[model samples]
Target chain A: MARIEINQSLCKGCALCTLLCPEELIKIGNQINENGYFYAVFTENGSCKGCALCAKICPDVAIEVWK
Target chain B: MSEKKIFSRPKTLKDAPFHFCPGCHHGIAHRMVAEAIDKYSLREKTIGVASVGCSVFLYDYFDVDVIEAPHGRAAAVATGVKRARKDKIVFSYQGDGDLASIGIAETVHTANRGENITIIFINNTVYGMTGGQLAPTTLLGQKTTTSPYGRDFMQDGYPIRMTEILATLEGTAFAARVAFTTPKNINMAKKAIEKAFQFQKEEMGFTFVEILSACPTNWGLNSIDSMKRVEEEMIPYFPLGIFKERKAADVL
Candidate 1:
């Protein structure tokens, strides 16, 4: 129902988005991106309520959500 | 006849739906800027230029005619805007990277020239818009992306206290550093910003506010922790108050 996208190279792995997401839709994965920064990945695509909380808490401007 | 209280947020800030996490001061800063716009009634006529750091979307956050500029170039662009239209209240919103780091040349030169504009400088110590990297204002021993262990004076150099740096420049009409650590501090910051705007509105000269903001994500702490760090660690490095005030003289 909702779509979430993260600029992998830009994601700073802050976990702020992961912590702020009430739906528990975002998380930091073990994989490293081109920038060597650990990126936060959308885990529960089904739970994301298109709230834009990830986009708000993201310090690096990494996440975006659309429904 | 009673005036109704407008118990509502600005139309530009969207709903209670914030993208920022717990304890983030960006929400508070956005509200303050909005409240200033409301107090001054400059939302329609004033134009704002957003810096390319943590508050890069300041234009999105502030209720005003907005324009985007490259990192650290907001002052230069705002300079051009103010010069072209003296009637409009032009302001630049920038973060530490955009102001103190990459844009230092622009910032200094703009203030030195006495551009009739107000600058809101949000200094959170690190390069927040990118990563938890060392910035010009990062504390001496703070850890950041570039300084994995801690900032070393011998190698990392000294943290820049920008208000003090700008105060000595004759072109600076007013410069101050204020914090948003608590409600009292927030009110002080608002008052300082108001005076800075009043300075420009009176065609006084360049005015700048170095606001000690919170960067929880970059600091590797929760939002409350970030605010605490600012009060405890960062404040010692970057002291608060009005470093310079030519407006006080001009009033005489």
Candidate 2:
């Protein structure tokens, strides 16, 4: 099992993670964040491979992965 | 089971949010440089020269001793700093407009002199800070504020390839061009930056890493489209690779 956490405050809703996630578990949420952007939310079904691709591509450095 | 944190913000970077545009790649380049600084434990002994342009806020994002240099004079300023404090690791963060256009003389001379320093050059084709003006590295047929009719070879000339040009100089120890269009490329960019710093640590000579970044707001495209443009348009003209790598210092 793997997990990833995204800091909503720092995310600018670029959606690069959603495009890069291999499992396609991350998506832009309907609810807008305080920063006025739709932040990405991970679908927590324990399918994350923890490859850290999203974290690597994130310009904001908002994603943190645990394996 | 104990969980391990795989990736997080680098310590050398300030906790404050980046002031770049929504889809700007300056944040990514800033993070890469910060990560490299943290990896080398250079926090205590590092000085960063902030150049003019979008990356001028480098001093604000990076938690290091930063000196503000006049437009395109980062290399010259960096040379003075490195010479004054020989023990400190010094680097300059410059954009294409600053490095290739206004500061070409300083940049080329610094590489020719083989000053023991590192330069992180960001090339995004247009001058992002100056309202998408034409830059020295702007691709042919690219439309900018100054070149709204598209850049003509006869008028604007060809886009200068800084990495390839710097590699030809004997004093340059390492010169590589990398882009962050993909995760794999982003990782490789990080490694290139680290390698440049490593060579500087060895007192080899001037090392330079040119990063092809995307400026979404300035390019009049969304974040994803701007990134795609880098892959489709920019990469073709500016091929990414190690242009030069000198293993040993040249005997003067």
Question: Which candidate number has the best TM-score?
Answer: 2
lDDT of 2 at B10: 92
- Writing each residue's lDDT as its tens digit, candidate 1 over B197-221 gives 8788777888999888787778888
lDDT score of residue B131 within candidate 1: 72
Output the worst ten-in-a-row residue range by lDDT, candidate 2 chain B: B243-252
How much lDDT does each candidate structure score? 0.76, 0.92
lDDT of 1 at B153: 90
Q: DockQ of all candidates, in order?
A: 0.03, 0.78
Best by DockQ: 2
lDDT of 1: 0.76
Q: Per-chain TM-score of chain B, candidate 1? A: 0.92
Off by over 4 Å in 2: B249-252
